[model samples]
Target: DQQVKQNSPSLSVQEGRISILNCDYTNSMFDYFLWYKKYPAEGPTFLISISSIKDKNEDGRFTVFLNKSAKHLSLHIVPSQPGDSAVYFCAASALYISSGSARQLTFGSGTQLTVLP
Candidate 1:
């Protein structure tokens, strides 16, 4: 099954606090994991990513940790701002074929993150 699972449908937090979102996968073939942030009616923006070779990746206030042994991953946002309030999606990809061979990612339903100002 291509199920990338985000157990929580939503999260709410006050500003300047930490926001953590979790994800799990059934497919062990996934070699690349990515996190994307989306606003309504817009495409998700690539935030950060971790190769299966690495256990963690970070960018600015965002961090992602992957536990290959556990088939699990999480995203952490420190001091979350109201601007951070949006849908966060966890996606997994395995190598695919094409001229460019763009990786095909399996996406979770997404977790809506709301940060209070």
Candidate 2:
């Protein structure tokens, strides 16, 4: 079964509005969470991340919130712009062993965001 999941397949928002994306994880071992944005055929670009120890992390217009108890996380983009239109993916990383040398990321399918101009 997929460890990470994004319930929403797509979201549309008007330019200059707020865009909210959500993700859920089933693994309690995941300690790190990241959000990536992809533009068509290009590789996914890192957006924001939050550690399990932190409830919230923000950068400029992007903010990530984590609810450990619920095993859920969310990404908020304020004042969404047309350039922000892309596919957003939620990823979770965890160490496979006590050595912490083998860490892998499990990613959600993706959520396409469309910002109407």
Candidate 3:
């Protein structure tokens, strides 16, 4: 079975601190990984993504590292801001992730990240 797991339900940090979120997957075929951030009453917005071929990807305050051998990944947000307070969902998809050829997203339960002012 393909399951993407986010072990932590929430994380809180002070402004300007680093916030880390984790995810794990059991499917070996998952070649594309993505992280999305969500605010209340809004659809998740894509934050960053790392193709399986890359070990790490970074964009500004966000960075993601993947350990293929361990089937694990993490998202790091540096110098967290109060506006960053929201739920973050880590998702995974492969070229064949969908059963019937329709694109499907397998999402983690999500972590509520809070950056205190």
Candidate 4:
């Protein structure tokens, strides 16, 4: 069973517009959340991250919001650009006391975002 899920497999937006990507999780143990962007044939690059302690985190054009009660999170990108077109992945990590680390990361299948000019 997939703990993390991205309901939308693809999204399209016009350039200079806002793009909203959503994700949901069934795991309550998840404490750390991350959003990654990937281009074709390349590795996924870290975009932004938010800890469970904070409900929201913002970095430039990217913002991540976590709603613990709803077990949901969303990524917002303002003024989306053509270069921002890529596969976006939502990942979560839960700390393991035995390992004292967040080694296991659960990833969603990913949502392909296309920014049309």
Candidate 5:
């Protein structure tokens, strides 16, 4: 069973507009959520992250919001630029009782965001 899912496979936004990406998870153990942006030939690069303790976290043009009750999260990018057009992956990390440290991330399939000029 897939714990994390990005229902929307793709999204398109006009340049300079706001772009929103959504993700949902079924695991209640998740305590940290992160967003990564990946280019066609490059590895996924960490963009922003939010802890379960907080509902929102922002870094520059990127903002991440988490809704624990709904098991959902979203990433918002304002004034979307061409460079921002890439695959955005939503990932979650949780502390496993069997392990002292947080386990590897559980990632969604990813949503492709295209910024049109």
Candidate 6:
């Protein structure tokens, strides 16, 4: 499905700089948003998340911003280090009541961020 899209397939940034990853979603029902970082031969790990009620959320050098009206979200990394280089995925989920359980996610293809020295 084209529910989530990351227009840029890759990104390059220098160490000690800022890196911005963009994502767009077509589904308005999505309320929970997340970002994941992954390395080669490894599964994606959760990085940060934001609920539709909030506009921004931050954790250390990583920050996620959600704009509900525009159906857009972005992840920002400040003073990015070489170790931050990895593929980043944007995910979205809508709460459902099926089987009294929820939390299935729709993920964007991914954006590869390369941090240079």
Model 6 Cα lDDT, one tens digit per residue, 1-110: 99999999999999999999999999988899999999999999999999999999999999999988899999999999999999999999987787244679999999
lDDT of 3: 0.93
lDDT of 4 by residue, 8-115 (tens): 999999999999999999999899999999999999899999999999999999999999999999999998999999999999999888768845889999999999
Please report, in order, the local distance difference test score of every candidate based on alpha carbons: 0.93, 0.95, 0.93, 0.96, 0.96, 0.95
Residue 29, candidate 4: Cα error in Å is 0.4
Model 5 poorest ten-residue lDDT run: 96-105
Candidate 2, which segments miss by more than 4 Å at Cα? none
lDDT assessment of candidate 1: 0.93
When sorted by TM-score, best at the front, the candidate numbers are 5, 4, 6, 2, 1, 3
List TM-scores for all candidates, in order: 0.93, 0.96, 0.93, 0.97, 0.97, 0.96
- As for TM-score, the candidate ahead, 1 or 6, is 6
lDDT of 1 at 50: 96
Worst 10 residues of 6 by lDDT: 94-103
Instruction: Write down the lDDT that model 5 would get.
Output: 0.96
Error of 1 at 87 (Å): 0.6
Tens digits of per-residue lDDT, candidate 5, 53-109, equal: 999999999999999999999999997999999999999999998877947899999
Per-residue lDDT of model 2, residues 1-117, tens digit only? 789999999999999999999999999999999999999889999999999999999999999999999999999999899999999999999977775656777899999999999
lDDT of 3 at 75: 96
What residue pairs clash in candidate 1, if any at all? none
TM-score of 5: 0.97
Tens digit of per-residue lDDT, candidate 1, span 37-109: 9999999999999999999898899999999999999999997999999999999998755524577889998
What residue pairs are clashing in model 4?
none
